[model samples]
Target: MTIREHNGVGKVTWKAEPDAHDYPAAASYLSLIAPGAQAGDLVGQLQTASLEHYKAKDMLRASGLPLLPPDNPHVAADLAKVKNNKALSPVLLIRGDLTLGIALQIADGYHRVCASYHLDENTDIPCRIADHPGSRVSALAAAVGGDLVNDSR
Candidate 1:
């Protein structure tokens, strides 16, 4: 199925042809975020993010991350591991473009990102970015045949 957000209307479709079914609440949410976009276009691609060094503080600032570290115990443990240079893996991220401009959303490794930033403003964290619309509620709703309004809190 395909959906297009042109102007303000969400054109829900299947194989480029408009389907008769009404869009669920999740589709409505997607429509608002990805205006002037096709449903297929909204979920696009995944790639290994460029190995560029970014200032930790700047990255957190751009992402609107809190100054305090994560409260989760696992995150704290991971942070400690990372600080000790025991974390051999990099963080997973989804490249995001919101009202705050471009930022990297932590799909995984929030602790690592926070730890690296808090430890040193100059620290650079590695990331694997998924450059796509990053919204799958609509598709999930369609699959489950559930209304997002009722299913989602």
Candidate 2:
């Protein structure tokens, strides 16, 4: 869906298939951070994100697409194996405009994206998208923080 300002209310133009590759950086980052977040909540957050922040996140995700040596090589290797085996997980989290903005600010899922790239340079995993409308970066960050805490154990 495309988001535009119309008559003061935000306008969303839905598409049959979302262009995952075309996703804005911030929203994508939020999806990576939340993993399985609700679409509605994500949209709400995206709507609230500042344009500059959103663009910054998008640039970060894009720049990190290529994996370099000595940085999470194990994860990168795991991604490669998954790609080689054709067994990469299908579940993905996609976000709309607002959540995308918040994600850009938090820079979530750098490792995961890098790993995914390492595994299969051409793989496009299925994503479950969120559409945040009125959320903030701190809230998204908190959600990511919780995930980190949970994964640490």
Candidate 3:
């Protein structure tokens, strides 16, 4: 694999996708893209929770990221979409020492989770959790389309 540098950081090109369950381990290496971020071992664990809208709001607020009212057109639209179809993927979350003390910063599917929570205070949210210190977006972004190894297949 060719090693390339971006902004003075070297990374080995991934030739294939790692197992879906290995996200946490991969995230630790990927955190190099952003300083003060860390990803812990995968728990191989998941759970369903009925999170409240206010709680979701609080969760997002604690993330230290700009808060978008659940009623925002896009948020509302996504909420409606989720209400109509509850078959979407789980909400992805990340947590780590440097991350805000918020319960878990949303790594992916924030809008969808918000919508789910807004639609029903007791909405059943399936979340794939991880321990990571990267900014919410960066953590998930790397997994989806950044320099970190991914399931490109």
Candidate 4:
């Protein structure tokens, strides 16, 4: 468990890595935006990805997702876990495409992010982040000897 103190609420503890189930959960969510194989690839990368930390406020800003209310059942449950000193499972994410104006994908743990925000926006949440397959098109094109346009106009 890792601890970080905040002014409004007490310390929030986080697991060293994402829970084993988190990968499947992330794959399920990713499938909504990508094909099944791509989603699976993303999850595979997440499984081997290094752990990282980012502030709750920054994540919300990057994700462009509204904060779930503290009264929300899921968020409340996470809050209860914090109160009970139980560590939260790290989040899983897919890096956003700035060129495409795509927002960061919080594949799993949206509730936990909101819960952490309610406790303290500055809370540093642990996560495993993976790049979207679209971002790797350049490398794929290079290997296949194909040229693609950057149509981001």
Candidate 5:
């Protein structure tokens, strides 16, 4: 989907795939929360995962993460990218395990997500998601013909 206005600027464009640098960024962030090896593993999964789309509001809700203010440096930079017609990279996510009370992890592109939210809460954000290795949610979902990554929300 195309977005016509963001912060009173030009249209929002999304990259067909995540930038090459995004994997390392995601691995760096994931390392803090998961084992280094597992972080690498998750990044690998994200690399091969199919692209998916979700509304900005739904991502924030599922992540249980507070939206970054538009004035935040990173967020502002992303807004500027939109203003300049630079395509933003697709977000990388680690699926949440509700049973274990783990909220979805925004492994990378939090600022971009916030920027998209600033544009429109209902804006569809492109994302690539991976299941947490230890989470049984994906397993159960697969068993029951449900999907853990591409949530309809």
Candidate 6:
């Protein structure tokens, strides 16, 4: 994953080929990366949730990480759900080249990353990053690429 600037806002973006290794955790994180979502808020919640998941499990495999005591009860509860399932959908945060700068600074998937720290703790998430010089060209290019650009002005 990489951070980039886009439309005067900082954003997170990723680029990776679709593969089996990618998981739901990444997808979940991507859903929350939006204009209004705060990085700190999401990261905290994700970490708490991951810890909660760890605590509930009796014995985790070598692939999993142990849960740590949580500062907030609410997060613990959310993480419990994740733990019970033993599997999560991957969330992805992706942006064209232009937004890479913003995404990196904001650390778009910070929450999920934090959560991963407690859950898997050793692996990196699947991030699909794109490279756009800046919004002026990237945004416009994305629109054109998607066929959303009607006016050529």
Give per-model TM-scores.
0.46, 0.32, 0.42, 0.87, 0.86, 0.30
**Residue 60 of model 5: what lDDT?**
96
Q: Which is better, 2 or 3, measured by lDDT?
A: 3
Q: What is the C-alpha lDDT of each candidate?
A: 0.44, 0.37, 0.44, 0.87, 0.87, 0.34
Compose the digit string of candidate 4's lDDT tens values, residues 1-153.
789888847779999988888888898899999999989988987898777889999899999999999999999999999999899999998888777777899999999999999999988999888776675553555577744433442
The list of candidate 6 runs beyond 4 A from truth reads: 1-78, 95-101, 105-110, 127-153
TM-score order of candidates, top first: 4, 5, 1, 3, 2, 6
Model 2 global lDDT (CA atoms, 0 to 1): 0.37
Q: What C-alpha root-mean-square deviation, in Å, does candidate 1 show against the real structure?
A: 18.3
Q: List the pairs of residues colliding in candidate 3.
A: 95-132
lDDT of 1: 0.44
Model 6 scores a TM of: 0.30
Residue-level lDDT tens digits of model 2 in 68-119: 4425665655445443442322222333234344432223334444454443
Report the poorest 10 consecutive residues by lDDT, candidate 6: 50-59
lDDT of 5 by residue, 19-42 (tens): 999999999999999999899988
Model 4 misplaced stretches (Cα beyond 4 Å): 136-153
In candidate 1, which residue ranges exceed 4 Å CA deviation?
1-50, 70-72, 98-103, 134-153
* Residue 89 error, candidate 2, Å: 1.1
Badly placed stretches (over 4 Å) of model 2 are: 1-74, 83-86, 94-100, 104-112, 119-122, 133-153
- Residue 148 in candidate 5, Cα distance off native in Å: 7.8
Candidate 3 structure lDDT: 0.44
Error of 2 at 37 (Å): 11
Candidate 2 matches the true fold with a TM-score of: 0.32
lDDT of 4 at 140: 59
